[model samples]
Target: MSQSNALIIPGLKVALVPCPALGDTTLLLRLAWRLQAAGACVTVASVSLASVRSYLPGLNIVGGAPDVVALAASNDLVICAIDWQVTVPLSNVAYLAGKKLPRGFNPEQPPVLLAGRVIAGAHNVICRDPKAGKTMVQWIDLYAEEVLGLDTSLPVTGLQDLPAVAEDADRRVAIFPTTPHASKNFSSSGFRRLARCLTARGWLVEFVGIPAEQQKLKAEYPGCTVRTFTDLKGLVDFLSNCAVVISNDSGGGHLGSLLGLRTFTITRRRGDFTWRPGFNELNRVINPILSFKWMGRTVWRPFIPLRRIVRALADVKVQ
Candidate 1:
C-alpha cells in the first residue's frame, strides 16, 4: 500500500468522491456514516451534492473537482469512490496527496489500500472502474469490511422519511416511469398496462415524476392517481408512504431503496449478477437484457418485458 493511503488519526477527513448517480451517493453515504461512527470526519464530493446534502450532516459537501493533494493535505485522508477521479488529470490522486503517486497505486496492480482501523478503507488499488456488472454498493461494502474493519452486514445507508402527515396516511403503490435517460426507461405503454393491472387487483396506484410525465401517465389510466412534487422533501415523503415502488434504473429507484421500501427497479446493466442476486434480494433489479452489441453500441436496445415484470412484482406481498 502507498503511504498516502495510510489513515492518520486525530484529524482523519474522508472525502468520498462519488459518481453523479444516486445509487453511488446512496451506497457511499453508508460508508461515510460508518467512517463518522469510527471518529473520522467525512465529506462527500459530488456535482449533485445539493440533492443529498440534507441526508448527510456534520460532514462537508464539496461541489465539483478539487485538487486531491490540497484536499488530502487539509484532511488526514481522502477516499476516492469514483474510480476515474483517482487517475491523472483529475489531479493524480494515486500519489498519496503529499508526494508523487507510487507504483502500487498503478491502475494495473491491486488497490494499494490502508490497513488497520485508523481510518476508512478505499478501493485505491482494486477500484472498480465503469462499475458495470456488480452492485456498486457491494464494492463499497468490501472496502468497509476489509479496510475500515466495520461490520458490512448492517444497513447504514438508508435515507429517512419525513415526519408523518395526514396526506401520506394512506400509502399506495408508486410507479415512477420517467428517467433522465430514455434508454433506462420502459415504454409508457408498459407502465400503463402495469398500472391498470395493479389497480385492477385492488392496489391503489400512484404515478410520480415531472408534471408532463404525470399528465401523460394519468391520461393512460384515469383510475390511477398521478402526482408531482416540487422538491426533494415532497418526493421523499410520498415515497416513504408507498407500499411498493416500481421505478426505472434512476434516482427514483435509488431513493426507494434508501427509504427501505419494497422496490423493483428496471435496469439494463448486466453487472447486476455479481452483486444484486442473492444479497440485495429485497431491492429487486429486473433487467432482461444481459449484454449485446448491435449497430456499434455495446449495450443494444433495452426492452423490458412488462408481463415478466408484473409477475415478478406480483410475488411480493406489499404492505
Candidate 2:
C-alpha cells in the first residue's frame, strides 16, 4: 500500500495542477515554493512535467486522470491553475467531488477565476492578478501573501544561489526566434537580421529554437551560433546571463519576465498589450502599431520592420 498522510504526519500535502504552458509552470514554481515553505509537500500534476522536473527537482510529478484524482483526494490542499483554452479534470467542482459541492460562492468574488471561481474552484481561486493593480510577474508575491499565508517581506531567493552573471553592458543577446504557432513568430528574416545586426556590432547573439529550426537556422546562417535547449532551467540560465531577450510573446518571453530580463515581446495581437500587462519595468512589450501609423493598414504583413523594434528599445541598455 502507498504511504498515507498519517505516516507523513503534520506536514501539509498540496497538489498544484497548472495550465499546461511552460510560462504557467514557471509561475507555478513560485507558488510551489511558497507552499513548501509553509510546510506543504507539493505535488505537481501535469502532462508537461519533463521540463519542470528538470528545473524543480524531487517534485512529485504525475499525470493522467486517475493519478491526478487520487493525488488530489489524498492531499490537504488541491489547486489547479485553470487555462480556459484547455481541458483538465479541474474544470468544474463536480469533477473534484465527482458531484457538485454547495455553490454558494460570494458573488462579488465570482468563482469563474482559477483560484476562486464557479468551476473547479478549490480552497482558493486566484484570478489573473486583479484589476486593482500588480505587475504580472509581481503578483506571485501577492499570491504568497493572500493564498499561502507566507510573510510578504521575505525575499524569494532560489534553492541554490545562481552564479553571478557577467556585468558587461556589451554582454550576449538571447533570442527565442520561434513561437509554438507559426503566425506568431514575428519575422524569421527579421530575427536573423537582428541577430546578425547585433552580432556584427560586437555582441554575441544566441538563438534558441526546436531541433529542426536550429538546424535550419545553422544552415541558413552558417556564421552565427544557435543553441537548442530541451529543459527550462537551461533556458533560464542562458536568459539570466544575457543582457536582454527578444521573443514573439511565447513561454520564453514570460520566463524572461520572471527572471526580470529586459524582455521585449513583439506581437501580432493588439490586445496582448492590455491583456498581458507584464510584472515589472524590465518586462516591456511593443508592436509595430505602436511605432508606425501605416502598421494598422499592414497589420497582417508577414514582416514587421526591425527599425520599429530598434526605436522602441532605444532607451533600453542593450549590452
Candidate 3:
C-alpha cells in the first residue's frame, strides 16, 4: 500500500466520476485540485452537473458516463467514486466506491470504502478505508496518498485560487435551511427565528434554495429575502459575495466550505462526520442530537434552540 515511487506525469489526462450528490461532488474537488496542480488535465463527470458545476469553475465537467466515454477514450485515466451500472470502455479505470456508511454500521467509526469488483475491467482498483476517524475529504486524500501515491499533506486550494467576486459592503449571511430529506432538516420555524436574530444583529440574512422551493420558502419566511437559483453558477456567485453560510446537513454547507467561507453546518447526527464540511478549518458542525437515526426528527430537529445557533455563529472568527 506504499506509494513512495508513484508519481503523476505532467499533462496526464484524468477523468473523475464522483457520486451525483452535491456534497460528494464538492468533496471530490480536493482530489481534482491535486491532479490539476500536478499538471494533469482533470475532468469531473457526473449527472448532477447543475448542482456542482458552479463550484468547479476551472475544472472541466461532463454530464455523465455517456459524455465521459468520448472524453475518457482520449484521457489517460478514469477514476470513479461510485458504482457505475454502465462501464466506460477504458483500460485504466479505477473504482473508488463504498465510502458511505452502511446499514447497521458502527456509528463511532469511519465508513468503510470497499474496492469491490471492477466494473470496466480496471487496471488499478485502489481504495483504503482505514477505521480511524476521518472526513470525506480526508478519505479522498488517503486514496490519493496511499493508492495514487500523491502528496496531500499541504492545503491544495485557498480563496485566492477561486475566481474573485466583489464582496458585499454589508455583512451578509446566506441561510440554507433545507435538505433533500425532511428528516435532515431542522424545523422551518427554527430557521426563521435564526434569520430574525441575525437581522436584529444588523446582518443581512437571506434564504437560498432551488427555484422549485422559492415560493414555499418565501411563504414560510415572509419578511426574509428568499432567493432561488436554477443553476449552480448563480448560487455559487451569490455565495462568493457572502461572508458566512449557515445551513443544514446539505450541499450549501459543502459548497461554502469548498469556497473557503466560514460555514456553520447544523446536523442531527454526530455520526455524519464523513459528511461534515472539513475543507476549511473555520467550518463548524453543530448537532442537536447524538444519535444518527430516526430520532433526529422528534428529538433533534424540533428542539434546536435559536440561542445555540447564534452562539455557534459568534464563536467562530471571521478571518
TM-score of each: 0.68, 0.67, 0.79
Instruction: For candidate 2, write residues 1-319 as lDDT tens digits.
Output: 1223121222667777766677666666666666665556778777655444545654677754325556546775566553321234333222221112227623233232222333222334344524544444456555566544455464543334444676763467778878777767766677878877666656677887766678887876667788877755566667778767788878777776666666777776553443242534766555654433374543443445566555555555554
The TM-score measured for candidate 1 stands at 0.68
Model 2: how far is 308 from its true place, Å? 6.2
Cα lDDT tens digits for candidate 3, 1-319: 1333344555778878877677877766678888776667788776665355655566777774535456557777777664552343343555455444334423223221222222222222222343454667777776676656576764564323344666552378999988889868878888887888877776788999888899899999997899998776677778888878889888898888887678888876563466677777867777764443454434676545458657866654433
Q: Report model 3's TM-score to 2 decimal places.
A: 0.79
Q: What is the C-alpha lDDT of each candidate?
A: 0.59, 0.58, 0.67
The number of the candidate with the highest TM-score is 3
What would the per-residue lDDT of candidate 1 be over residues 157-253, giving only the tens digit for each residue?
Answer: 3453354644433347788887778877777777888888876665678888876576666776677678887655677767767767788776776
lDDT of 3 at 202: 65
Q: Is candidate 2 or candidate 3 better by TM-score?
A: 3
Off by over 4 Å in 3: 1-4, 46-58, 63-68, 87-90, 98-131, 154-170, 289-298, 315-319
Candidate 3: the clashing residue pairs are none
